[model samples]
Target: MQRSEMPSINTQERLLAWALVLVCVALLFAQAPHGGDFYWSDSPRHALNGVFVMDLAKAMPFDDPAGYAYRYYAQYPALTILFYPPLFYAISAPFYAVLGVSHETALLVVALHYLALGLGCWRLARFWLPAAPSLAFAALVLWLPEVAFWGRQVMLEVPAFAFLVWSTVAVVAYLRGAPPRWLYLGAALLVLGMYTKISVAYMGVVYAALIAQRDGWAMLRNRHHWWVAALALVGLLPLAVLTLKFGQANLQSVTGVADAVASRTSWQGWVWYLQQIPSQAGWPLTALGLAGAVMAAWRRMPGLGFWWLGFGVGYLFFSSIDLKEARHSVFLLPSVTFFAVLLLHTLVPPRVGHGAVAALALLVLATAGLTVWTRPVFYVQGYARAAAEVARLAPRDSTVMFSGYRDGSFVFNMRALEGRRDLHVMRADKLLLGVAVRRELGVEQKGLTEGEIADALNANGVHYVVMQPGFWADLEAMQRFERVMSSDQFEEVARISTPANHKAHETELVIYRNKGAVTPRRRGIDIELKIINRRISAD
Candidate 1:
């Protein structure tokens, strides 16, 4: 290889990288949803939280009281705002204020995060690969199905990771003698990442390992590093306090008391995450990442070694947790993609014609771009229409019930779309389980009888019930639902059916109206009744 030819090769690579960046951006915009309908259950809830923050900031009345209706398990029903750290919501709040609180505005916030993710990954990759391959690597990472799927929605994974990658880049730069300021910047970004999602705290382990390998125990002696560490800790103090106070409440809010019923020691969680790698990261990239890790180990490449460590430890740590989810693998994707691209560069023989290599890279990019563009949008189409119907048909200020685990879409649409804060929207299951409700209604601990359930609904002034068949698939639930439907106390109001799709629980929305308030019959003679009978007999 001639030294003179190196400059020309570098120039060509730089041009290719920028071109890939543009292509990735174009694909993302093409795929983004332009409507107010949310695609995922959590997205609408998260967006509503942002709106909650926005309303509070502006001194406006909280627009959605239904958001506060559900109880976090046996604990008293409280606002849902505290379940997650507020960084993502805080950043999104202003967008809601300016753009108007809608799914489109929430998506705008996600798109900004998406752009940051791509740029952050490109910058991080530059530490190892040249300009061209680093940009190409960023494009490939962005095109991964998980990234594309989550990036298009208002979710925490992509936004949190954008800061995490940039933080990694900053730490690497400081270690390579960029400047002391880089270390502080790295520390600040790490704090932001933690605030975004607590899962990113594992990055600190990677940072510690990298420093130890580079300078043995001596790096700890550096005052600048200690100051940076202190700053990060101070930055995290508020979050630490909040977590200590509300951590259990937050966990209960999401998982509920059912976490106690589910098997926590099962090996299925570990297996599930292992199986996701091939689909989450395409098989081609997964294979390349494995090869890259082996080659990097053989060559003793410290940078790649640190990445492998981060990826391995993060994967194992999350997999060991009882709650298994594919989205948790998102943070590990950047490291995996980095190694995959490194392997690609390594395996491409220097003797191979430059034009051939260029063509292969372009081919991969084109295929990925097309896949992302054609990917199905998974919005709940029925909820928007159902919400509109409810607003139009149901009397203003009437209590309405939603019976499902995924009721966020309904709550979001009723409040955000219809702007109906006067309506008391409740989840039937949550209402049944809520301890406060039981105390208020003087209901029995053993559970409500079919008659008692109807009595409780009427007593609470619930005028309408929205039932979804998929939510009542369990035998007991279905039986209860049937009993409620058969009761003479309620009449069928409206039924709306949507086109069949796998994303929603039920395509049919059945609305039932309370006919007349019926006094509930006591199942057994109460002590008060017994006391009255004895007094009358004695008299």
Candidate 2:
């Protein structure tokens, strides 16, 4: 009411705003360098896309691997892949354009992912909270051990989340009688997400549901919405071009694969759902998010509530139908945290906004700081150290195999070997076979026994076997394959292991030289990596 008081109020608000921006920038920069590294990041696939785009940029020759827009390169949405390549490549283009391919450039791209995700989180928080609370919430999401850590990886999770949050703000604004940018941007981002991962197709379901609520059956009565949908479809054109040029499978085949998997494990859906809530939910975070979502539902904030419910149900259902992996839960995390923060702010009044902001900011900074400093010691540094030793010590022609190659293929593909091709690398099929067990039995499966493993090894012509201490719960079980290496394992040929990987089934990678009779030599090594889709397993 008073002139001097007004100035004070404005200054306070300005400080809050500046503080929020500063927090976001600081958190993002903390994850800027090696912080993005994950054991089995989907980075290789993202990096491959960057490579493809670079091919496009340099006017290098190219080919369409698949003709179907959504079915190419593993049934991913063509548009999603097309969308991120340019974004990712731009960050790495200068270095790669000069030095060719290097992880250094990938580090830069992942850092950009941090920045993008941070911006998106900031935008989304603004829609729900006051300036200080909103920014603090964004920082909280950014520094989440999972979020900050994986956000920097060469993966689509952060990018997909970034787009989702940006579009959410846009769409919610429009629904509140604002403008069309939200709807358009949201749709574009949704399409982008789909290309990044087929999991994003769930967003379409969310949108359709939202529109139906807003306009009733009348929503479908208007062709304008359909036109918008068509535009989104058109946005997928470049991906379509890529698919066609590459000779990829059509969308029908892609969905067929999904359908088959769903049909096989339709029964264990609920059990899988229960299992994920504990591990993937981030302990207290999931509990907090769920509690918050309930409050939102009770408070008539159904839009946000529905978003969480839909994500949780959709992700759980999808996980059940296929195989469940930690990474699959990535998209559901933001929604979980979003609702959690919503609930937290609601429970705590703004009377203590300054204190609350400080506490939350301190938590995030502390977690991020710990991760940044210790990540190399436990995660990246360990892997790098192990990989370096393996490269240096393992015979050049010795086939390198990951004892527990769950999702660890990315590390195997990129890190296990240096720039030389003399090393023969092979991943054990026993671990990968878990993917197939769910499809056939309608329940989660474990790795194979010794006899089954022997058959698998013989069939695949595995020359070197890697195992950790935990990999053999019963050492007597695997007596068939003589252990060539042990705790001594060739004098720390850097038994490459990751920190996040539990000691259970954690093989120290005993390089058994396959003393059993070998299969006849062929003209070329026929290496078939076992594939286990929930509905099917390729032997």
Candidate 3:
């Protein structure tokens, strides 16, 4: 290459990098106007963990953080942070403290992951193709309806996916014998990915197998591998402790769900994800990815080969589990993207005119634009307003009980109070219903009786009641609770109406003020913790 050509090549690389930046930034702005309320049930729960971490940080209690954590859980039963890993919360705490916790803060944290993922996609794709082609592929990956689906909400998939992408990039660099730090970096990212979501642990197997296949088993004897393994063990220590204490619910959920799903499906169970690929990913890319996979394995493109291995193992592993979801197959997107880009890059010969290559790039960018611009988006409202009204009416440190499908939204909004951290938020679904993770809800045990519920509410010093008809219209719990709230013991203070849209179901919430309440008694938080524990561990 002539010296004159070098400037143009560098300029093209910089332009492509900036293009990827602009594309990812556009996605960040896409989620900004939701008023910090969530649609998905789990999204708010994930966001709450961040709030919990920041609250704990501010408290900086000299005594026992573990005790603080327990009392906090007793206060907010919607919190299942114990069931999942803590890495996301750790990442989110600084953002919460700095910007204040809201849906926006959570989405911003997810946006960082999205932007990092776009970077990883660019770096990984650029390894195999030219700058313009790489940029196109990364943009498409970000635009995949599936990626954007989880991307907008504060879920673990995009965050875990981000870690997987960067980890793969580092591992690929290490595979080419770039540097030792790349190896450790890959290991750290893999561990981080697992901590972000346990589903990514299979990726560790993907890494090991790729390395061993590349360098032979003698690579196992390398001291660097041993050192990284030791570091990984230390990194996983917190998970080990959490698993011992709170993992029963997760384990039961997986196995019990697997058993249930296995009974319902036939031969389609194995091929369910493959069938949905065309919809989740576009049909054109799906066909290209298949062809690309065949060509790459036939020609033996090493990095593409690594992703090929990933797609195979990820698909088989997730499919073999009795439960199935389209999101579970998200890891396959990289392999699909790799293959599709490789095919296009292969089609366009290197000697082709720059104008022709530029046209290909424009086509991909246009497709990405269509994906982002045309996709429909909706978010829930009313929770933030309801939370504000409750916070304003209830006294500080008073317990506010909520009963609804999206108690997570309610709890998350309540926790947003920077100074009113003392307010104890309770979920009626968790306390009155005692719905264990493994048991089918509304089928097993009946909820607390009205008299029992009244005594329990008064005994706990309940001052505010936020109830919605989250159950069947005739559900004894909903009916009995309504009867109790409507009685002279309580007065309807507010009727907050929430309109249904997307994941946010429509319902009328009646917030009641306890009129006959006295300076009632308070139960030990530990006793509440024990009751909560039974909901998790029992099948």
Strongest candidate by lDDT = 3
Instruction: Give the lDDT of residue 285 in candidate 2.
Output: 65
Q: What digit string (tens of lDDT, one per residue) describes model 2 on residues 1-539?
A: 00111011256655555566556656555444342233433454465455445544675334633223222222111122432324444445555566555554665656555566666666666555656556656666666655655665666667666666666666666555555665777788777765555455676776677667777889777766787789988987765665454322233233334434233245554455545644543456667777877887787774453456557656754654344445556666667767766766667654775655654565456545655554421133243444444555544444445554332433333332336445444443332333322233322334355566555554544445545444433433333223323322222323454445223333334334555543432223332212212121221
lDDT of each structure? 0.66, 0.51, 0.73
TM-score of 1: 0.81
Clashes of each: 0, 20, 1
Candidate 3 local lDDT, 84-178, one digit each (tens): 88899899999988998788898889888888888888887755666767777787788776777777788899899899889987877777666
| lDDT (tens digit, per residue) of candidate 1 on 217-273 | 888898887898888888899998877665654444234333322223556645767
TM-score of each: 0.81, 0.62, 0.88
lDDT score for candidate 3 against the true structure: 0.73
Best by TM-score: 3
In Å, residue 140's CA in model 2 sits off its true spot by 2.3
Task: Kindly give the stretch of ten consecutive residues in candidate 1 with the minimal lDDT sum.
Answer: 530-539
RMSD of each: 8.7, 8.7, 4.4
